[model samples]
Target: MPGQPSAYHPGPRPTTPRRHDVIILGSGIAGSTLGAILAKQGVSVLLLDGGVHPRFAVGESTTHYTLKLFRLLARRYGVPELEPLTSYVGYRDQIAPTSGTKRHFGFIRHEEGQEPDPAEFLQFSPPSKGLQTSHLFRQDSDAYLLHTAIRHGCDVRQGIPVENVELEEDYVAVIDKNGDRYEGRYLVDASGFRSPVADHLALRKPPKDLKHHSRSMFTHMVGVRPTDECLRVGPEDAPPIPWVEGTMHHLFERGWFWSIPFNNTPDSRNPLISVGLTLDERLYPKPDDNNPEAEFREFAARFPAVERLFKEARTVRPWVSAGRIQYASSQTVGHRWCLMSHAGGFIDPLYSRGLANTAELINSLVWRILDALAEDDFDEERFRYVEELQQGLIRYNDELVNCSFISFTDHALWNAVYRIWCAAEVPINLRFDRFTERFLESGDDRVLREMEKTAYPGLPVPGSHGYKALFDEMVRLCEAVDRGERAAADAGKDLMTTVQNSPVVLEHLGIRDPNRRFVYPKPEDLRRMAHWLRHEGPRELSYLTTGVGVHGRPLPSALDEELAVPH
Candidate 1:
């Protein structure tokens, strides 16, 4: 149920005064994972969460980049338990058995009353089988991580509602509802949206700064039909990977529907499927009835295919809805405290970047915090880079999701924008994978700082000049479409021209035929693409930009005056 609280499990009461190296707010995966890492390093850490584990939660998807980051973190920090959750095979063997394997990501565009066109369907498969991710059963995942943290010697207390947090020059004091006080050298907030630390510190920023605006209604259900079976596309037209074998998205003009299966395996006991409807509130306003399940059914019925898929599904829990899922913080770090990536801000779930962002932030912050502790400094200025990284990720997600909403309104724009997204996504993942591998080989923290410098909003690393220029142009065109300043057809044509002329995007994406436009490369092809990117891609940037549309174009004098590359 939406606001129903779980049964509070009162653990041992705290009587004696104690001080730890760090006091963490919230025992969610982010907080627990960070605590476990620090505790494993012999640091005294305490994690507190208002809600109990095995409770309902969302953000249930993962990606290749997420897997890579997890593996890197585990290997770098000596947390073998986390390495298991990085892949489908490992997750099943080591983690919970209730999770689902995500071999590919599938999307289908639908009209109001008509079945979706097979030609408009898009499926994105990861490069290799080892890199295949999973649809995380967050309840199980969170509980497992909490146990992992406890096993690592982190002092954890559940059902402890935090009342106030006091930040001092040398330590932080946390007061609970019962007026009990806990103190530690540093405070970290990992509680999602309702962050007591952020609220008390007055660090929240206006959500209007985000380009994306959305509301969601979601719940766990049973009996969702397989997407491929429901769609009934011809064998020849079917995706190389089965649509039902991964997280499926049913996209429409004003919104999108997510169908994530949790019982894809035969041994799986959980039959529940996590389903959600996200609507652009500006285009589709909520009904006044205030019934989430009813509103979900009414909205799902608008598309015939979605209606059929959910015909036999029955909700196992009450549906939950939110007014707006976008939020930001004016500051993510203070004199003696900081907010987790999610605790600071969240844009949307359009690309399943939540987990990836969370893992990446934890990885970076862990090292920074250790460094700060070694130097006996907890100044906010020391952690400003963490703030930049978090805000930069939110800005990137905002642009991606907001522009994606515009693409959904027109098939032509969708096709072009989807390609552009893939182009940006592939190389970015490849770069991060390589960067992590290198950092693992050489334990130099500077490698990470240098890698962070290359961070251009979305891509994992700062790519070639040609790649940046191409992506920037695409963003400009998409932003124009988002604002209704450009027609979809015209933008599509321009995007196609850009794709046709740019070999970096085309070759990286394995888009050999511009006419066919949709190509699913073999695993071997992707492997070769990664190899080329690491060895020869950087040296060829000048040649790659030779025939680009923006290349050699005379810039306006005012624009030239404003353009200066940072040192």
Candidate 2:
């Protein structure tokens, strides 16, 4: 990780006889999570990692959804009451100028003379600005997860760096830095930013999925809160929280900042805060990288508010760091192999999606692998299904991330209207939460409906278009306001008018069909249909009904073939 996540030749296996059901590489969250899950299934999992976790790392602010998975995992592992060892009281972001605000739509920076076109906004977009601290990486979190992994039945091997895997006739063999050989029936590439197995086996390559606007640097400091001031002069929220906190992120001209809440100490009457600021190279410079640490301290000194947090903040002893904000390898799996690569490899961390996406991969892929080994036959159908599911999830997340950060070119006029319409109360608008819920309850039909719904909400939603047309009118109003037709007040008034008249107006734009019923998974009948297909085996139409495998491809040989022999 000191180097960006990549591969290194692990040399050769020591040619000793070692065996296990599964071989895992990397001990970061993704790999550890996988090891624990498999071990719980009563499978023998040999988890390998180059070094220990709690290494210099960032990208803390986790979303509400992450807790849900933790809850589920805890329940399954018999830890009924697991509190967040590390929790974000709220999320925070460093308020700053996003490329979208400058490039895509015209914007009135709270300052002045800042009008950005849409294209630039899309290229270098950041989430709409707001907040300060997030409670994502409060040391307790890393410790908690490692503890949980150990609590489960995982066999963790730290400082045992895995170089690559030899996809063998039966079992997959692992070779480490010191020429140790171990083989497992299955190989899981949970290697983080550095995907050793993926790189070695040529299963996938890292993709430069980023554009002109990507630079990230972060370090955690304790005492990020103000001990000297109360609400009178300090921020409204306590430090040790996440991006949803107060003006923490809302007061910047360049990239976003994150100050997370963390526990103080194992012994004592206080808690500490973890502060992180992510600035793009475009604005925050590394002009004199000769001493980046001194430069950062000097930079923080320039911004009084930012400086206050640092000056008062505590360093959690041996603060750590690594570059996390970058593109992920676009491809994950092939016919005979797959990857468990998480850690912002295929996505961005703007919405605190890194962890949530990681959970998604584990929840989907881990089980299929377990069931495969259990049945002594890898369910090729299930593998393909999970594979596609992973792809779909990636594509969906890419959209959300890209859409949220895309140049705010249309922010004032066009962009603002599009995003705001989502906030509007349309007759049958499917909110994002609704889409996620449906996806969980039932996989395929629900997913398709979500696709159509999110794809074209105005046409897709029953009573949303009046709002859509209202935005087109808004652009016209923007031109008028610029020309002094009415006041900026008049344009603001129009926005309200549209809001008030939305239902009727949307009817004109095609919202009044009057028959907005649920459009997915037609009840138990389909499930019974799926049950029938499941028993039919690979040739059965049963799998079709369940949405459990790839639609067009045959079941994978690993899944459809005979029992795997031990090496």
Candidate 3:
């Protein structure tokens, strides 16, 4: 049944034009999930895809934000089927068996013929089990979602290419390769990179504005060795979450390797592991031969540790390579039509933000569309906020990913840069969790809007100045490293000095004393910090954590031992 669009009963092609409340291009998770949500609301939906189910696709990682959004959408929209996707254990029984539990995000810097320095390795674990995420097998996950859409009364057609889109005043018309016409109040393009809607409307923007520029080569393979076993790190020295238990990132100068296991347990159906190499295009250009497999081998050999991990693995599918993967759209919304997240814009996948971004975009758009339909207003103005949100998110992503590439030049710099990433990510994750909980409890769209105001587009609420300052400094230091203007040792020392001097960075890293720098906190410390932040007043917590007052001056801190107690 793999690749089969389940519950689909194909009959004779439609002889007349078909109309629905909404028409979605591309049957991937984004389109199908939106379709299912709308269909459940008694809105007629049609989803068309150029390919069939169980298709090969990447972007198979999930995060805390993605899970929280899934839960929120399912609960708010009355779609219980999506609730299971929020947890690893629930997904195992309710979704598919092809996913792997992602307990931690691990990274190690490797050099040619030299073993990675254990001291330089980093592994980040979520403080709580509920926050842990999973690595998806997109083929299975997407098909399951598509089937769910069908079950929810969405009209889905596969292997059908959309040839033309005509936007009228009130509705959009879609013509397929078969000359069949479909019309709907709104047209949604989730068709991804080569978006026809984007191309036709001249929405595609040159990626020159983006800070990050990179190319990728990737494939799914079998017989890949577990990182723990390959590295031979002793159990005593191993991280709380084993490196093999989650996504492993092997870093080197100018590039990085991602190893995401699909088979972590004996029950996994697919033994294939997803592996990919992403290189900063400015530093490493594409190989002349253009054989991804051959190029991949050559690249892997540069890191002996990475090469050993993949030495015996055989590809389950053809290796795929792409030129600079960054893209952006000049506009995402027009009369009677709009583009989904991927279609609107996309940056690098280094942080696995794609799924989370898609979820956030869908959540915002679906509500707006529903409201617009109720009011009988489809003006382009109704969904303009979504465009702004999408564009801002992509810009934020560009900044973060672009800065991260500088880490590869040296392990010390990588460590410094990574702390900045963690500082930014921690608050964002917590704020998103809080927003989801608050919105679900109140069922208030205003809560969503208020939270949106505090966000830096693709980030969390309260937009603290401390976090912003840290991020800004990180970017400055990274650019300096990238330009070879700062020595790795000096950069590392500067990073420590920066962290020690910033109360916001200290709180983010769960350190109370600046004297003890770059220390990972124990589980208790993490839990205590999270509880304190959660209990504090929103505005007060923002200032306390970010070190910026409402007037932009450093806020006086009342933080002490008493506030650290868990409620």
Candidate 4:
């Protein structure tokens, strides 16, 4: 009965609704992963998916924070299978062998009818060479997670769309397209844009106030050449990492193009590449023809280097075109139902924050769900923090990406604003890394729980006043540029000045200096940062000193010795 859903029942279909402790719509990675954790914990779960496995899906990138969350989830929930997803080595060996290894995040800015300028680029790698990230082959990864849930005793239904969600005083019922009913103590809609829980509750609302406005069209493809091979840059002008080894962003004035290759690694069996173009709908209005392929070519043709990068590409599936991909809900939870992650809202995929946000939501929400199940309490008040966290994450991302899009108009502005993002990303990763390292060392749930009892619940660097000030100023400057009240050049100059003086700016990275185009911290840089953290770093970042490991070595002296370079 555990692995069986209504779709795969061998015997006669039950007339009575199937009952479970939790009923989740959409068996994508989010729902399946949640299902696996809950099922392993002895919570009866039913996972419903309208689609099947090995399907083409986007959002294929991962950050250090994302992978760390995977490790934490695996250890904390006792789901050892998830351990493989926490690193490139584990994923390549135990999971999808063809998944891409992401060593760095690279952005190359281009202008109309011109080759990319070597100086007008940015590359940021995790400080340690050993801490590799990944470009997910989502189809395989999603299927793997779903089956993991099944093996852990979570029932699943595939190819059955939920037609309606009925929420009552005690339980929730899901009615499928074929008139089958499923009942559970609680319902969670991890289903994307067309979330039945959101629809039933009339919670889906267009985020018109959201400053970020973008349309996206994406598909998996073969024959797309890597930028390293396509671009005519000399070794002296090359980025710190090969462009093919990570997610590449080809930025222009009004939009950006992403290239994620699954064929980057040596043992990779997959030759497919994930390709997409996202444009600010306000700047590049949708045309009447609605041809995504033609539109992609037209945009690429403007940037000479970008055109060569995708010249040989062939789409394996029809491109998915979306309009203004931002959406928010009036509420993410009700009496006995909740909208999980993307079901609640979504911004653009500029920084690959989707999965990271999903991880945060799961980490924060699951404990509450487990406790409520134990207590038999379904009060909406119990989930107030989850809603707030979701909203805060969305709000923060909206400004970050909205400013990023605005900054794309000029290289100087983009350089300054880019550092603003690093200010938040670096510290937050360190914070999570430190806590995760401590938990792994001590096997203490309290270490992970300590992360939740923070004043800023959903943010990466919630306690840093300097980060907040920098982010606030960035929003102000970008908003001023948007209003045509401030020139982009002047704003960039002002931001650079502020970044130079900002306490959140890590001195060793030289991000505050506009001349440093690539931010790759060496072992010595880590040692310097460790020293700074111990002495000069802000008091708010003191939490970063607790068991923070770098490149498989502990902080301070241990890291220094492990990474010592010969004189």
Candidate 5:
């Protein structure tokens, strides 16, 4: 059963709290996740946010690995078991056409540098069992996250905007919008880009934009059903009850759109479709909320593809807009006070990375701050670890972005470009492997035990060597991609195939257990038939046939989820 947050606690809360272990501002993914981690650690945490529960939000995409994370959160909290959520049919059950399923398998349209990378979307729809379970984001994720944090004992106070913070010798005191104060040993800026703590402490200087991907503006709708014209395009099948991403750019250039659906209950009048326009700023001007309709008109006039997508479509009410953003923290951490700078402050949604990064960062930082407070002193070393965690995250995005960049280029030289970029991002990958590493490494096991209590599972991911090979091969493949060699056309595909065939891949993908140690069909073993691989699609590669369509049983159903592991 959910915790009794339904209890009507009395009004007239205290004005100034003397002290707590830590103070977190922002209740989005990062703040909530970190709050949960810290609370479970037995640390007294104060989390203040600007919004109420189950508020409207936009981002919903997740890679193949997100299922494990969500499962972990569910188990940790006292919520019902995650199995139902995982196998929930809401996404496929939306009231759209039958063929309206998109990303049936996970999709990864990788573009190296602003170019279309078709194969980047994962192999096909329904990639694996738990794969479809990940589709229910945006709608249920927030409440799921908030309750989890509360279960961990986070002192979450919502709808209170923080106004000022004073860093004292022993503790930092924060003033809310109405001048009430709360004090704590450490201050965490899980506050998204709309950070009051960072602003109060002046932790941020000018932010430097990293390798930006593109921008997006979205709005909610109801009764906007999917059509056949939408289906034949990329990344859309029917109105997915959970979520749908449409890469209009793959079908057209510089034009991208997506549709995410949810149950129409409570707040909404009808099922909504999140229609969007994602494009490079270099090509079209940014949309202005000051006059979004006018800004959109300007874009439609200038960009033909975007015009066509929105021209005929009827967008329902509750129109919302968001920037497809990317950027690096100016100084996420400083001397006395540091910013746990969660989602809103970092880069935008290119590979659907924002929410995962947000939750992970929060969980990591809150644990660190809690540990530092437990010691009766601020553990600078733990904060340093927090810094490393965020840096590692940024590096992962860098690699992912560059992977899309090179994949999109499709230039003969792209292989080299990709390889070199991968070389750089590998170490970060090794360091930022999982949230478990962050929770377990803390000297104080209190937070960790709480995490364990919550049922967060370890993401059965690859080890360092697999990561190193991936990075090295990425560079090598980029170089290979550049050479335009016969054997190098789609080196990414070959590498993925080889890795999937590896013992570790089988284990990570849940194909075969490591203890049992069953060997897979090796890339080298299949090299004899490279001639046919030259002209095959993901569907063709889904088989285990002999040369030139030699008949074989269909590939394992698990291959969709298990083998197509994201780096």
Candidate 6:
């Protein structure tokens, strides 16, 4: 039954040339999700892919922000199906059974030929209970979204590689390998790194100026054991949660390895683990044989803990070796055509930002696209903001990941830099949850549009001056360390001091405490955060507690008494 078409698949590719309102390249999650929304709104969409579904793919992690965006999209577009993807319980009951639960982000730092120190690990969970993340089974998730698009009347073509794209003044023409021609009033290239639209237009920036430099080798495997099985630490030193309960990142100097299990839950039927190793290309150059599985094994052998974890594992799919995973396009939007997120640019998967970035782009893009379609206006100027936001995302992510790779050389620096990541991620994710809450309560699209009119283009919170100032200073210190002007230890101390003094960081969360390895906020912690924001915190972040509790819901009336008491 592998590669078989589902009931929602549109059967039989049409031989005749056809015209559509929008022609999308790549039927992966982003493209297919967009296609489904547009088609549901009565627009004709043509979705094309070079391969069929139930295939191996990566980008298998999700975050709270990603799920929040999905809920917003589902609500705003009247597509209730997307709601199921927003939570673990809903996903297991309504979606596929093969995906895994991600209750936290687990990171364990290691040194070559040494047992990983218990103190070197850190685990950060959702702000509150019941906020469940996921390790997506991309093969099934993609196929499901593609099916949704087809059910919404999107004409789809699979296993048909696009040969060429001709972008004219008013419409775009696509040529297939079999000499079939298709036309559309607008074109969108989500085809990823080897984008046909980007290639035809020569939109790639020559000698890519990306600051991050890394290569990756990835594949699916069986018998990949959990990190808990290999740890030498006792129960008292054990991580707060089981290591198998979330996405595990085994990091070393200048590189890292990811293990995402699909069989984490008791009821899960799948037995595969999505494994990948990303290395700084400058440190570990390409091998002669170019066999990725062999390369991965060699890299894992350097660390005793990593070696034990993978000793019994065997790959079930062909390995993909990528040289320099960073890429950027000179232009993201042009006359009668535009490139999707991955097509526009991509950085390393260090922080799992790929899917989150894609979700952000779609939330801002789809509405403008719908408006343009109604007016029959395909001017390049109409999508100017999309272009700006897309470019800014690439620039910001490049710097973030570039700095992270530099920090990997020293654990103290890596630990300090990670707090900076939390500073940006936590507040922004809280705001996103707030946005979803308001939209769901009032059914007002303006609540969502507020996300688009930001003073900061690519940064998480648009108007929060407190966090932005701290972030800028942190980057300066990190850059100094990278340039050999500052000692890693000194820079790490400075970074922690900055976090400790910043008004934006909630002290109750213990983010400023270097000794605290895990951050799982309890109800009392949330109450303290709310009280501080309401009474003691700076005005810049006071808005975070306006109508919602720390959990992005209305505060229980009884909690007022608890908020008044000191913890």
TM-score of each model, paired residue for residue: 0.89, 0.58, 0.88, 0.93, 0.62, 0.92
Residues 242-324, model 3: lDDT tens digits: 67888888988767899999898665676889999998887788878899998888888877788889999999898889989
Q: Sort the candidates on TM-score, descending order.
A: 4, 6, 1, 3, 5, 2
Model 2 regions more than 4 Å off: 1-17, 53-56, 76-139, 202-208, 226-254, 263-271, 282-285, 288-290, 314-324, 335-337, 341-346, 379-381, 389-567
Ranking by lDDT: 4, 6, 1, 3, 5, 2
Q: What is the per-residue lDDT of model 2 for residues 1-567, given as tens digits with 9 covering 90 to 100? A: 121111222224334436777777766666666676666656676777787766645545544345454544444333432333112222111111110001011111111222212131211111111211234442334544555566765666788877656875556788888898887777777766667755675543344344323345456555665422312233432222222232233123434444444443222222545455444455455554444456556656655545654776646555333343544454565433467646225555444556655665665566556556655554346566445555555554444333333222223332333333332322222122233333444443324233332323212122234434554455556546545675554455565455445432222221121121111122242233234334532231112222223233332321111112110
Clashes of each: 1, 60, 0, 0, 52, 0
Model 4 whole-model lDDT (C-alpha atoms): 0.82
Native-structure RMSD, model 6: 5.8
Superior by TM-score: candidate 1 or candidate 5: 1
Model 5: lDDT of residue 361 = 51
Over 4 Å off, model 4: 1-17, 548-567
Candidate achieving the largest lDDT: 4
Output the worst ten-in-a-row residue range by lDDT, candidate 5. Answer: 510-519
- Could you tell me how far off, in angstroms, the CA of residue 480 lies in candidate 3 after the best superposition? 3.2
TM-score of 4: 0.93
What is candidate 1's lDDT per residue for 324-389, written digit by digit as tens?
889999888888899987899998788788988988888778877876666677888878778888
TM-score of candidate 1 against the unseen true structure: 0.89
User: Candidate 5: lDDT over CA atoms?
Assistant: 0.46
What TM-score would you give candidate 2 relative to the actual structure?
A: 0.58
